[model samples]
Target: MATVKVTDLAHQDAQKMLSIINNQMPQLINQLNSTGQQMSDPNNWDGPLAQKFRGEVWPQAKADLEKMKNSLAQLQQSVQKILTNISHAGGA
Candidate 1:
């Protein structure tokens, strides 16, 4: 079989990674907003469900948001690296 170049693989991976990140961004934003709202509401803080909801669920949601943000940042960096690689390969 044929050997594939690193540049070609990087570009393809970058595109796919960008697509996945873009698709997840809206859902992540919605979750972050919902969690923020819940945390901000005084009633939610004092409620019976607050122990589980706020302590566990909200914290997990916040962690998910952080993970999503980090993933997106990494994906952006990967795309930038791919573009740089492509440009340098073309100029050489």
Candidate 2:
């Protein structure tokens, strides 16, 4: 049977990455929301192209953002699971 090894440093690094992802996600979401709001404002941007973007492209972008958020959450969960496994391996 093959052996697998995980180190304390790996666990720490994973935790740090998880923290970074958790922190950055909110900022990303806020930026996207602010951008969407700014673009949606007619006073800020108004034209047929803007309307087309708001009606078509904007919704797709929002959906893509939501998908990305879900993907990040999944990644966080996977990292948490790895941390749990590492702790169980006596690396915690």
In the range 1-92, model 1's lDDT, one tens digit per residue, is: 85435556666776677666777676867777786767757675767676667677777777787787887778778776776666666621
RMSD of each: 4.9, 1.7
| TM-score of every model versus the real structure | 0.52, 0.84
The prediction achieving the highest lDDT against the true structure is: 2
lDDT of 2: 0.87
Q: What residue pairs are clashing in model 1?
A: none
Considering summed lDDT, which 10 consecutive residues are worst modelled in model 1? Answer: 2-11
Candidate 2: pairs in clash: none
lDDT of 2 by residue, 1-92 (tens): 86768887898999998997799786978799789978978899999999988899888988988888888989999998988888888887
Which portions of model 1 miss their true places by more than 4 Å?
1-10, 39-47, 90-92
Whole-model Cα lDDT per candidate? Answer: 0.69, 0.87
